[model samples]
Target: MSFSVNKTIAQINERIRKGKAVVLNAEEMTEAVKRMGKEKAAREVDVVTTGTFSPMCSSGMLFNTGQPGPQTIKTAKVWLNNVPAYAGIAAVDAYLGATEPSEDDPLNKVYPGQFKYGGGHVIEDLLAGRSINLKAQAYGTDCYPSKLQERVVSLADLPYAQLLNPRNCYQNYNAAINTTKRIIYTYMGPLKPNMQNVNYATAGKLSPLLNDPLFRTIGLGTKIFLGGGVGWVLGAGTQHVAKPQRTERGLPLSAAGTLMLKGDMKGMNSRYIRGLSFLGYGCTIAVGVAIPIPILNEEIAWFTGVDDSDILMPVKDYGRDYPNCDFKTIQHLNFADLKSGEVEIMGNKVPSVPLTSYAMSLECANTLKSWIEKGDFLLTEAQEAIPAG
Candidate 1:
């Protein structure tokens, strides 16, 4: 016998009352599945925590830098650390994206701007309680007559700076390599030529959506640890493509589900969430997210038993350009072989290292476990699974 949402919640609440609810992180749940099997594991483990720490370029933050001047300023332009914050909104409200580079960055003459101090880095500074310079301009009006405004601001001075990312955790990702004899700078970090290096993302076996697979227990309104603070799965993210090919185990062979999460940037820890400057490339934010999967049924338990071998991703040759690059020919390999630190590609043994931080992912998972143990967090029934596209 297994459980429904209400039944599982009741058991969890009762256990909490007795100060003995069983909680396990992804790694622990995987082990419990092997030792106790699906049935026992389903009944014994209340929640399974999953984490990912990687650069999510789709991330951004919205801030309420309160009206600083006596005259209302309908900000026509906004800049935070040289990065343009979208001023299309109201006067003092703007959104800064991780990948958004500054206007002055192009003058550096690099093919790709090394946005060392862009909006992403600005967020890190704000979290660190460091003062960041903010400048805005608006044509003077009859009532709201404010031509220009500028100031230094900190997180404490604002109402809240919310990190609302349209796409955060990707279901899966490619392990990239450059076959041509030329060094390339792409989003997956700099690629050394002639398959000299392989950079892979994704938490592999420990990824959240992969653990749930079919989105059975991960959906809208599901509470998650996002950017070091609690957030919810708002809805299906852009390009949440339910791909055609999937393993017999039901996990996608390509990137499938995506998540849009938002949380208060004020309460988040700077350590788990960070910003980066890719030397010749643009800026990116390394966001940490954790999802707690409720073991509501035997099917859920079966899904949670998934391992590195069950998850596979493409090894793309980034040397090609445009539409051809989109349809580039390559092999799909299991995360198990990728985790081995080497993979045989075209008879050439290539060394592979994860650009994403698995160690930090584990730490994020463990941190969520402590929250559950301390009764600081509780699971909410996922509103609805991500439907087939």
Candidate 2:
């Protein structure tokens, strides 16, 4: 059966009017789906909350760093606590990429995994009320001329430090392992060679997009709990693949739909959004995101009901370049099997590591519930449907 957006909105409004809007968290919804059945669950449940906490390499922060340093310094190079921040923009404005490593000690050939600090970590430090050393350099010029600048900056010091993530919650992701003999530093984290370990991002069955499957209930303008504060879906994120191999339920057999998210970094704390440095690998940002899914109809209910067994991810070789073309040779495993801590690949029980934090994700969902209950947030419809791949 098809879902009606207008009808769903009315149902939600009525429940809100009656002060009985039933909002269920991810764990609760999973059980509700099984016990109440899709039809009944759809009829009763007003909202299904989904959450995930994972490393997003595409995340960055735009900062206003208080005032322009002594003299009108047009910052050409910027670094915060050894990590690089983009400072080529207008004076005093800067953007720090999550994956940017320090110039002095970057993720390189000699000691690839030795970096203890990254752009993400610098952000975390600044959020924790710690002062970060800021240094910038520029060529002496007739206007806004300053060759050097240095100071300490904190979140309190900057009026604007917005979390502008070009990409965040991926629709899906692959489980990566190394088939080669050498260890590989990858975006999915270090992959152990010879199928030693499989690393996967996303909370698997608990991810937001995984529940929605099709973006009917989630799209641009969907308000989400992002890095501890409210954020909105701007549009399709970078590398968005609208279509991928799908199962009978329309859930992808691999990574699919993605979201471009933006939020105010000033209102956030280090508790939810943390900066991380991968040994020998570059820096990456870990963001917490959660959304409320309206049970528009039975189909949505069924989609929300998808459990670990319903989701499958391809185990690919991270040793090779990304978008690995040899996907046919990759083994697909269900989240249920993957969640077992180990999965038998080629008759060998290989340990699996979740790159996403389930605990943080649950916190995000519950936090959103509190927001809805407090009437601080509401569901919104996308102005336009997300385009297909």
Runs in model 2 deviating more than 4 A are 1-6, 10-18, 66-70, 106-113, 140-143, 320-329
TM-score of 1: 0.94
Candidate 2 has an lDDT of 0.81
What does candidate 1 score in Cα RMSD to the true structure?
2.2
Q: What is the TM-score of each predicted model, taking all chains together?
A: 0.94, 0.91
- Deviation of model 2 at 209, angstroms: 0.7
Task: List the pairs of residues colliding in candidate 1.
Answer: none
Over the stretch 143-204, how does candidate 1's per-residue lDDT look in tens digits?
66888888888888877689899997898877788877889888888889899988889887
lDDT of the structure predicted as candidate 1: 0.81
Best model number under lDDT: 1
Best-fitting candidate, scored by TM-score? 1
Overall lDDT per candidate, in order of appearance? 0.81, 0.81
lDDT of 2 by residue, 83-197 (tens): 7788878877889988877767644536755665678888888778899888888887878778888888778878788888998788777888887898888777888778899
